[model samples]
Target: MQTKLTRFSFIAAACLILAGCGFALRGDSSIDAKLQPIYVASDRESQELSSSLKRQFAINDVAVSKRRKEAKLIVIVKLLDEEKRSVALDREARDAEYALFESASIELQSPDGTNLRGPHTLQQRRLIVNDPDNPVGEETESTIVRAEMREQLSIRLARQVEFWSHQLQDQP
Candidate 1:
């Protein structure tokens, strides 16, 4: 009886050691293994964000205008601000350039049939301003700021999605 007890104890210790080392199967990622498709409305920034997400995750993209898209992960982005403040002046004391801060707000909802609405976020920020002296007009400067915001927002949303995807893999 003592010999059998000792053998069981050794086996249990070895199993614990293996578990502590994070030895688990790989195929199982998140409780919902089913590929939850992602879809987003076109708000310039959303378009960029959707493209970025598509590249990162194996998700199907659907048009927001389509009724079925409502069932999947839907995201909408609102261009919050695109302001520029005079940071410095030229030799003539003219408003040489402005320190621009670009901010965007996003709404993401993973519906009931698939995944519930996530943390209600997906935001991005960046500073962008055109060369005020490049002879570019105010319109051109505005365009540059919008473009920069789109690019930066795309990067931030992609990173957040990747992090969430990894979290899914670890949990039950």
Candidate 2:
């Protein structure tokens, strides 16, 4: 019985490792994956952008350390707006459903920092925080929105990566 249990445990561990448990996980080993240790500009929005990019591309997708000379790409995202608008307004400008709009200009570059993909501004809009400040169900909604934005950003970044990757591949 112990032997059977031990064998099952081994199999389970193997499966988990093969599944990429708790390690760098990229959608694929694309050019973006090869360009590890990328640099992201310092800021909250940039942080989110970096985190999201890492998720889609690879862990440590956007390196924050300046001393890290190995970093090839430097991505800068400038926040344009973080506004709240009334969706369903009352007689006055009070007590109404609100919407949040966020806009940023995203730029990706080569190792020398030449423009590879954007400066193609992307905008993300969503509804206001409905759940006061409890921070419970807040995650569910925020996660959904973040996931959506991440998908959009990934598609754009992937296209850029593919373009550069193809260029390099065609060189020789």
Candidate 3:
């Protein structure tokens, strides 16, 4: 019984220490009220990116307006470039590794021509190993990596918005 009590007390103390240090698990990020009702815009080539951004906003309990006119802020996202190139060659002179890069441009503005966040580039890169014996597997792995990069870029964009929102709240 004494050992059990000691163990419980230790666990409780550890929890308190972690909480005091500002350590937190990632979850919904709060946005300022001034940036509410945001609209995400994307061209046909960037539809996937827009969809992922919308998902991030939804997770944060933000409502995305269907009409641009109804939004207090507009977030425009465009795919700028994508490239896949061999980075390594095997002993047999075949491809051994590939570097994948993707970049997108983001801009935040109000409907009345106020720039909240200037145009900036968000980029993501991933290095993937290629299996010369399995061509199909290599292709599938590359595809999966690309998808993950897109999701990562979306998360970054969401964080940018959160930062802008907090900045607005701090301003006079």
Candidate 4:
């Protein structure tokens, strides 16, 4: 009984310390009420990022507007650019590993077109093994890596937006 009580007391103290330091879990972050009815605008090539952002906003209970006219805030995600480069070579000078780079620009603004946060660029990279003998296998691996990179980029973008929203809320 003494051991159980001590353990409980330790946990309670830890929770209080964490809360006092303003540390919050991911799901505990909330959006500002004034930033509701957010409009997400993106080119056709950025559909994946736009969709991912929309899903994240929904999860955070932020209102997403399908039309720009109905929005108080606008988030623009530009089309993604992808590049492939050889990063490593075998003794024979052939490609042994390749790096895939993907990047996109994001901007946050209000209805009046005033910038709120930034026109920031977010980038992601992944290294893939090169299998010259099996072209099909190499292509398949590249596709999978690109998809994974996209998901990671989306998560990072969501986190940045969340931080910026909190900053906005903290303003005087």
Candidate 5:
């Protein structure tokens, strides 16, 4: 009975400590009201990133406007590029490892086209060790990694918008 009580006490204390530090789960990060009704405009080649952004915003309970004119804030994704290259070679000169790089050019603007935030470039990279014997598995792993990278990028973009929204709120 004493051991069980001690375990309960420890768990309660840990929870209190985490709360004191203001730690929150990733999904609990809330979007500011100023960024609601946002429009994400992306080039045809960047549809995946656009979809990721819209999903993130929806998760945060923010409505992503389908039309640019209906939104108070607009996120423009000018370009998204993906590149892969061999980083390591096997003994027989075959590719043993690959470096995957993805980058996007993004800008924030108002409905009137006034630049709110810069034309910034965000980049993400991953290194994958190849498996010559299991080529199909390697391809599937690469695809999953790319999807995760896109999700991470979407989170980053959402945080940027939240920061900008707070700054705007503080302005007179």
Candidate 6:
């Protein structure tokens, strides 16, 4: 009985310490209420990003509007460039590894054309290994890597937007 009580006490103390230190488990990030009903404007090249952003916003309890006129905040995402460069070469000079680079510029604003947060550029890269004998496999693997990179980029962009929204709201 004494041992169980001591263990319980230790666990309770650890929980208090963690809470006091502001340690929180990973979960959906909080977004500012004022930034809800957002409009995401993207060019054809950034359609995937826009879709991902909308999904993320929904997950975070923020409303996304299909119509710009109905939104209080607007987020513009533009695909700047995409490049695939060979990073490694085989003994016979064939490409062994490649790096995929994707870059985009993002802007946060009000519906009335007020710049709220950014014209920030975000870049992401992913490495792919080429199977010299299997061209089809290499192509498929590269596509998968690019998709994964895009997903990661979207998560990062969403976090940045959320952070900025909180910061702007806190300002007097």
**Per-prediction TM-score to the true structure, in the order listed:** 0.51, 0.51, 0.85, 0.78, 0.83, 0.83
Arranged by TM-score, best first:
3, 6, 5, 4, 1, 2
Global CA lDDT of candidate 6, please? 0.86
Write the residue-wise lDDT of candidate 5 on 21-108 in tens digits: 9998886446566667889998798899889988988888888899988999898975467988899999978779998888887788
TM-score of 1: 0.51
* lDDT of residue 132 for candidate 5: 74
Residue range 1-172, candidate 6, lDDT tens digits:
9999999999999999999998876467577777677899999989998888788878778888999999988999887888999999999888899899998888999899899888999999987878898889988888888788777787788888888888878899
What local lDDT does model 6 show for residue 30? 77
Over 1-172, each residue of candidate 3 has an lDDT whose tens digit, in order, gives 9999999999999999999999988766688766789999999999999999999999888888998999988999998999998999999988899899999999888887588886989899999888999999988998899899999899898988888778778889
Q: After superposition, which runs of candidate 3 have C-alpha atoms over 4 Å from their true positions? A: 1-24
lDDT tens digits by residue: candidate 2, 1-172: 9999999999998989978766654454355445555665536756665565556554424333454356766666566665556677545545345565666666766667678766766677777545444446555766776567655664555455546555655665
Every candidate's lDDT? 0.53, 0.59, 0.89, 0.84, 0.84, 0.86
Evaluate residue 52 in candidate 4 and report its C-alpha lDDT on the 0 to 100 scale: 80
Tens digits of per-residue lDDT for model 4 on 1-172? 9999999999999999999999977663366778788899999999987898788778778889999989988888875699999999888787799999999788888898889998889999888879777778888998888888877787677777778888878888
Which structure is stronger by TM-score: 2 or 4?
4
RMSD of each: 12.5, 8.1, 4.1, 5.7, 4.2, 5.1
Which tens-of-lDDT digit does each residue in 30-129 have in candidate 1?
Answer: 2133424555444664455455444434422322323434435555545556566776677777666566665555555555434433543444444344
TM-score of 5: 0.83
lDDT (C-alpha) at residue 13 in model 6: 99
Better of 4 and 5 by lDDT: 5
**Number of the predicted model whose TM-score against the real structure is largest:** 3
User: Candidate 5: deviation at residue 136, Å?
Assistant: 2.7
RMSD of candidate 1 to the true fold? 12.5
